[model samples]
Target chain A: MSSFPPFTRLAASLPDHVPFVGPEAIERERGTSFAARIGANESGFGPSPRVIEAMQASAGDMWKYCDPENYDLRSAIADQLGLDVEMVVVGEGVDGLLNLAVRMFAEPGEAVVTSLGAYPTFNFHVTGFGAKLVTVPYRDYREDLVALAEAANANNARIVYLANPDNPMGTWCEADAVEKFLAEINPHTLVILDEAYCELAPASAIPAIAPLRPNIIRMRSFSKAYGLAGIRCGYAFGPAELIRPFERVRTHYGVNRMAQVAALAAFADQAYLSEVVGLVAAGRERITQIAEENGLKALPSATNFVAVDCGADGVFAQKVLDNLIAQGIFVRKPVARGLDKFIRVSVGLDHELDLLAEALPKALATARI
Target chain B: MSSFPPFTRLAASLPDHVPFVGPEAIERERGTSFAARIGANESGFGPSPRVIEAMQASAGDMWKYCDPENYDLRSAIADQLGLDVEMVVVGEGVDGLLNLAVRMFAEPGEAVVTSLGAYPTFNFHVTGFGAKLVTVPYRDYREDLVALAEAANANNARIVYLANPDNPMGTWCEADAVEKFLAEINPHTLVILDEAYCELAPASAIPAIAPLRPNIIRMRSFSKAYGLAGIRCGYAFGPAELIRPFERVRTHYGVNRMAQVAALAAFADQAYLSEVVGLVAAGRERITQIAEENGLKALPSATNFVAVDCGADGVFAQKVLDNLIAQGIFVRKPVARGLDKFIRVSVGLDHELDLLAEALPKALATARI
Candidate 1:
């Protein structure tokens, strides 16, 4: 074998794998397109027309590099949130920001706390950084905030990650309860509240933006409700002191110029965002109805997706997911132990949801066999 | 004072600063736009029409996240270079890939070798990762390849970074010399060959893609000759084993979807690239003549930008740069000791170059005072 460069012990120790298999990969592997693209939790309603127009107008100006500071976008985000621009740092995506957070807050061998079945990308980063993961299992389909706080104090962890209106399960904890959890946690640990799906969530589930705390970094994204996931834009707001450290580690020009332009336009069109939220809510009801017809329980959700229980074990849920993929219906399921009995489906356009409604019965029937 | 979350030892020790102040920041501070946007080395000619068309067409499809694997773009790159798909990885930009490389290769307190004045972004990442930077001085305004190789071996450095068609000086070492340097280096040390401006350089300066080395990662970008700097897309290719590990640490969806489509279209249009090359060459000669007209010497460049010696000192060059900026002409200068006596100007649109020609003598006369 040819000799190779030596990777750091930490990097070499991590598994060489992608955290999630993107829908494009599955399509390439199957040699057929998914009839319903209700997978991956992306908005199928697309970005606002104004956002697309802005992107198209700036297409010829792609020769210039993006602003390294992300000043304009940061200012806009801060303006909307009633915070100083220094309190916000825009990144390529929330995933990118999370990667930086792990490096900034957690050293090698330090502990990071999270719920067991939360966003895998956060776990991937903690592992890549050689940080020890202390996971708390979900309590009754929601993140066990009290257990997570206890674990953080017990382990003296440097960072704790929580996603409100959580992924895969689409369950959420009330904002007031989350605030209580925050108060109960050790002040030395940084809390990363990934609010990517916040816009799709109910107003009560989102905390008021005021009184910024140094120990908390709240992340928001254009990906979920703004419908600009493909553009790769997200922002994190925290105390100015904490946000300043991001300069030391972030890829300065990682957020593309087109992303900045599109995000700014999307942020301006709150009307479009509200319309999409209503559409998503109606689509979730349709999915719930569809699950009822199949005699399965659809979990109550606050985000864009609904998780439908397969009424059996993890094995049965896996079979159902495989059968759905085989039938050219793209959907994902939570893999964590208690959560594996459910399949998660994002709200897509009407035709896409109709196709999912058509495919679920056949998929469930096949799994029963 | 409010208590803050505990940051890592490395993160705490680093200075919170931007490596380079972007022109947008300058514009914001000065309250005026640059009349001639020839600084930062972005192409004034812009990307091809087809690439723009592709970006505009995909603007509405921003709801889907990018492929984590970057499969199609990697396949096209591998096919063009006659390498296997596994040998390539696409990133947000060369800057993003450099961030990953530092984390993967250099552990805290380990050494990384580079020229005293190379890409500042690379230096930023090295410091951010808590790696010691071992610097070698430039020889004759070009990177001293022999000294760099020696430093890597002596320090037992994990990474040695060299930009072919070196930045700031716009000088290059021939392919044969680079190969010799590569052969003499420690096999265990990784060599990062940043070929960002390779397309503008002579073919003799670029080594053949065959005979892949396990220790070398060669990076290229659509940011330069392809005129897509704002899109944030670049790729690194090397042996498959080394490439695989990037997946472990990379932010999977960091590269945006429009970037993929625009870059693929950019890659397909080699004719536009050649035309840009011809334009850049003519522009370089014009800059050289302008330098001579102002009683200075313009260094021969293999890259798109020309570095003109001020025929005085670093102070004179700084004054000239300041004067240009005062007149709303954006230009940059090298900050390292020997290279600091020169001012660098990127080729701009014809009218912008004409503005440069009109502004030079006045700026020089004011600097002489």
Candidate 2:
């Protein structure tokens, strides 16, 4: 190799592969647009009309950089969560916040615990920071809390991640079980409760904001039920001590003003959020029905997406995903070992679901073992 | 000290202070908004009508996450600069990109060089990554390029930052001088050439984009002449080898889709850009004339903002700033040693400038020592 500027051995060891391929890239490669655009679990229903109006109304306000403190949005989020503003720190998205939390807590070479195939973004961050990942396998398609707690203790991990109503698998452990996990995990481990999908999940999957536990930081996203994923806004809530460290390294002005406006307006429209949750539930049921018609089993989900077992190996699931993509649909499959047998599908608009319905049988037949 | 959770010794020593307090925070504290919001070098003229229309046109597209690859925007920007897409990387703002650059090149305790009172955000990033900052003094109110190159070699610095037509001082070096500085700096030292004010400056102030310059990364922003600071979009152009490492740690979806639409539209309209640049040049002249009417020497500037020597010490300059603030005319002043005698004012709309013109004499009298 030609002599190159040195990277920290940690950085050099890491490959340039990203955790997820964005939808636009897929379109570019396929030389076609996705007809149903529901793969990322974004709310195709869109943000509240009031939020769109707010953003359009403030287009001229683009001259000013967003408030780094995110004072107004932080206050709005704090009031809604019934916590002090000091307990919440808003970020670019839940993804950005996860990176910050991992950097703050996990030292180089220390193990970070999480359920296998939970949220790969968290694992990406851990690996990016050169922290070792200790993954516990899922049981019953849900995060196996007891096993994760033991792994944290055995590894003396610096952090443990759990996403209630998890992505990829679309499974969950209820609030009581989460509390049990918190109590059982190594006290030294900082539990990052990623609830990015919590708003769409059954309320039972979320806990009352946990401020007493200094080791727990819970993250939530406006991208889910709020329908503002493109704007990149999310916040994390925790004890002041754990939350305050984000100030040290965060891109203070990373979240833009439009995101602030959209999120604030989204928060104000509780009626709209209630409607979105109901629609997501309906979409999930509709997708499950589509899976049944295709002779596959749809896993019971507490999330906005359902994971349908392809009734064969990862290769078969891959074929199903490829067929969908070739047919101009954009759903994805989990690639982690056991989870690879299922293809994940996000709830979409009626037309999009119809497209899915129209194509699933064809895609399934294409993927026959 | 009371016992606390352990932070790395270096992190524990870092202070909690931010590089700058925002104008919004000032308004909240003062219980009134600024009549002339011109301190931060933002385009008070606002984004192009076409850009605003584009954002409004796509207001409904906020449901999806931004393309992680930033495909279209990168392609547009790279095409504009006559470079390959691989040579360009978009970030939240130059501030966010600076953080990533420092993280990649300079390990903790490594030396980074820059002018004494250049862009403090760059210094903030350097300090953030635990890099030692070796600052060369600004001579003649402009960056002393010879001294900067000397210091870079002296310290064997990994990065050297220079903001032409610099912030706080508002001065520039011609293209030939910049090219000379680049040649003098060691190949191992990555020079971050921040041309944030490039669009507003004389063309001679910026050199031709040199894609082969392995030692330099030029930072530009939509936040300036494009009038989209609230959008949090900026890009760095450099050799592919240096830019490739950014992918290792960057938040893939950090840029927003609204920003992409707005920038693409902004770039598509060069006639509007020319009109805005003309207005900026006019505004700078008006600001300079206003400062001279009060008997303060307005430094010759190639940027959107002008630095007026308050004709006294740091305290007097600070008084002028506070007096402007008290009169609801928001302005900023330098707090560093040599530059503390100057107050910086940005170009704003006619009425906003009139507000500043009306406040200047009174604020000056109040600051009289």
Best by DockQ: 1
Q: Provide the RMSD of all predictions against the true structure, rounded to 1 decimal.
A: 1.1, 1.4
Interface RMSD of each: 1.6, 2.0
Candidate 1 ranges with C-alpha deviation above 4 Å: A1-3, B1-3
* DockQ of candidate 2 (2 decimals): 0.62
Ten contiguous residues with the weakest lDDT in model 2 chain B: B1-10
User: Which interface RMSD does candidate 1 score?
Assistant: 1.6
lDDT of 1 by residue, B271-299 (tens): 99999999999999999999998888998
Clashing pairs in 2: none
lDDT score, candidate 2:
0.86
- Candidate 1's error at A249, in angstroms? 0.6
- Model 2 docking tier (incorrect/acceptable/medium/high): medium
